[model samples]
Target chain A: MYSNDGFRELERHECLRLLAKVPVGRIVHTRQALPAVLPVNFSLDHDGAVLLRTSAASELVRAIDGSVVAFEADEVDALTHSGWSVVVTGSATVVTDPAEHERLTRTGPSSWVPSPQEVFVRVEPELVTGRELVGGRSLYGVDLTGAT
Target chain B: MYSNDGFRELERHECLRLLAKVPVGRIVHTRQALPAVLPVNFSLDHDGAVLLRTSAASELVRAIDGSVVAFEADEVDALTHSGWSVVVTGSATVVTDPAEHERLTRTGPSSWVPSPQEVFVRVEPELVTGRELVGGRSLYGVDLTGAT
Candidate 1:
């Protein structure tokens, strides 16, 4: 369904599919009772959970573990003014199991920053929603304008 | 200053400069007591406040007014593995003054999605922090891997 503002709602499967195509995303979590966002390189697990690798002692690990957070990924074409954005809201937890950690270390996303030790954080896809901005359709009888 | 992870901290003026170069950004806020993120076309005001124009009745408008929110923008190069990200955390307030609203209508960011009526949401840059990933340095003697 399309919203009154001209964005079409994307299905769950479509959302997950689009999410896996991107290599980087932003993670949103609360810091000191206020919202905070950080860009991170991420991958999608077999069950569509967002997997992130970061320094084990990083502040992100402390702020997001055992808390509800939002992850967003998108691809936009400035010329065509077309793109899709997917947001996954779910609980995040640090991967602590030895065997699971070993497996993830071998198969999960690699960190952009070089680190001596890294840990994986998993965000389950509990709530997924997305919107697509289609090109050339003027809804609400208002002219569509490009970002300024 | 460079962090242990190889990211260089950007100064406040540099953060605002980088923020103005981008046409789009993601806003992080709390929705129903859970963190949520949405991509929006935005612009910078004279004082570097993040300015967003959206439908007056949208969920984002209701979720962030008078609340602290985070706004993030970035530019990345996959081949060079270099990028800079700036995040602005501040209180958001809907512009209600008629004179200010009229001024913004002429000078503020134009919405990507067509809307009959729009309102401006301003985020004061209370805490601005940024990081730059410099290219081709084996910091800490570890190989930097590209996003996978």
Candidate 2:
């Protein structure tokens, strides 16, 4: 699907694939009844859930636990003005089960901040949407001639 | 001010300064009661409001008009693991006044999409907050030795 602005809409599978290619993303959630965004390093689970590791006592943990949030990741080329962006919207829940926590600790994304009390917050990809700006050409460099 | 996780807190002026350095940022807003994020090219007004150019008929214009939203911009170095991120929470309003629209059309950010009906959206910086991850050193490459 193509938007009126010429951006191509990506499929769910394509969105998830593009998301896994980037290590960092911005998390959007409500803070004090207003929206707030923070950038963090993240990873994708096999089931496509977003996994974030942060200090257990962090403000992010307090704000996003059990709340509907949005996770967005993108890669852009300034020279070509071409890029793709993916957003996943769902509930964010801090992992609390001992076994699950242990598994995530061993396999989840490494924290930028070295903290012993880091915990994993999982965001299910309940609504996945993405768009690609191709700059009048196809991904393979072929001119679309307004055919995209 | 510093957080328990070692990330340096940025003051309001510093946050605005960093925000002005980036050309692209994520806009976070509520869509159908769920948080949604989209990357947009923006410029800061003289009063620190974020100015965005988009099609008047775009979904973004519909979703964020007269609503509180978050605008976040950042620059990160993956190799050095250092970066600064700023988030501005404010009300987004579509510029509807003819004089203001005419002025913004002459002075505002250029549209990425070539559309004749593009309009400017202004986001007031009601609340600005930012954080800098310094990777155990000062921004000038000097060791802080835990003194920052």
Candidate 3:
């Protein structure tokens, strides 16, 4: 659903169908020169990669110290404003596999309450775009799987 | 405005007046161990420190690379349920003095439509905390400098 020169293009199964209904997102970059945004709790791996975990000293990891990133995820409904978003520009490495770190330590840990240190992050998405506002000002787009 | 463990103890102008009133936040950390969260656009520096910016190989610089970090910012308001939050665990350097980085550059270049490769992040809170939620239950806290 992209055709206006603004190019919406967001495929890859609609970016896994709007990133499987948002668990929270916002991971913009640039840390010492100014723009740094963070809000995590993401999981879209099964190959769709976008897993994240925190602590072990976090400025969201000194503003992306592995470079090359632009991860974004969205879901809106400010009372029916309608929404959908997925933007994942690539190259954010740092997941030295040891059987994928024991399958991310058997996947069962995410806390923001008192303490939950010991870091982890993996977002390997070359490029993916999306947008679907519909009914708050309409702006459509789809099939942007890095041009497939 | 706190009582639920009082945000684990907060101070630094009550964490910069709950970070001026959180428009939105999330900047958890950890890049090598995996956990990471990002979604930021912040304010609260007049020596209260917590600026923003990133780039130069991101991962928040591999989780605040030279270490001693843990910065957090929060906001909530499920509608009239009000909201307020602030967390700055302190010490996450990398500013490379350029007249103090052009005196903490800010004022323009973001309405949240960025993607030119982004860069900039500067958080130095030392230890700030906050809590506030009126109506959606109840939780109040203060102490960025006001103390409560």
Candidate 4:
């Protein structure tokens, strides 16, 4: 059901399920104190950690390892004007364990970009939130008196 | 010619032109000091400012006015494993001038989500950067020894 705001909050489980289905997402990290958004291809592990493959030489891999980052994915139909977005935030750490790294390298989600993606980083989500808009409608009916 | 990275840097004018063609993009803003990303329907004006329509009652509308934000859009072919992403960063300000507001409301990009989107915010891009991956390839040829 759509609320007055025309957005419905999705449950955490539902958000993860949606995240698993999508192959690409944008990763947000602060660069020089300004927020930078980079579209990345990622996969969800059974434990819900978001996995990414990047070149060890890439700025993203160097700048964000062991640092906090936000990953987001969404599916919106341009015609229906309806879609859902899921955001996951957590510290991203490199997969250093040899056995685990090998396992992931062999079977984890693959990267779409052609590069020497030797670095495998995992973000263990500390927070997950999602919202869905069911349709396009006139916002005129919603109260905006408190708008800033 | 493709570089060793297999990625090509896009010029600012080209990036803006591409951004103008997309009806949707993700906006990245800092909330409570943490980076947050939200997808928004947007249109680029002649001067290159990113325009958005949002309900006055929404947190994004209230929190981002006069704040710096990053907006990004891209197209990636799953089969070809190629895509380009453009990100624009600038200060977002709420339109306060009545005449300009009216003009924008009458002709600006329309939102797909039905809600009272009375607030019109614009981000005059201070910087724009983009990159394109030509195709999927093996990462083995790229040198990774210098990778961070």
Instruction: Estimate the Cα RMSD of every predicted model relative to the unseen true structure.
Output: 5.3, 6.0, 18.8, 4.7
TM-score-better candidate, 1 vs 3: 1
lDDT of 1 at B7: 64
Q: How many backbone clashes does candidate 1 have?
A: 0
How good is the docking of model 2, as DockQ? 0.29
lDDT of every predicted structure (CA atoms): 0.75, 0.75, 0.51, 0.74
Residues A1-120 of candidate 1 have per-residue lDDT tens digits of 776555677888989898988787788777767777777778888888999887777677887899988888887665566787888889999999999999998889876665777788
True contacts kept of 3: 0.00
| Error of model 3, residue B44, in angstroms | 19
By lDDT: ranked, best first: 1, 2, 4, 3
Candidate number with the higher lDDT (3 or 4): 4
Candidate 3 chain A: worst-modelled 10 consecutive residues by lDDT: A138-147
Grade the docking of candidate 2: acceptable
Count of clashes in candidate 4: 5
Query: For residues B9-40, could you state the per-residue lDDT of candidate 2 as single tens digits?
Result: 78889988988877778788776777777777
Give the candidate number with the greatest TM-score: 4
TM-score ranking, high to low: 4, 1, 2, 3
Clashing pairs in 4: A56-B147, A57-B147, A137-B114, A139-B115, A139-B116
Chain B TM-score (each prediction, in order): 0.86, 0.86, 0.31, 0.85
Total backbone clashes of model 2? 0
Model 4 per-residue lDDT at B137: 42
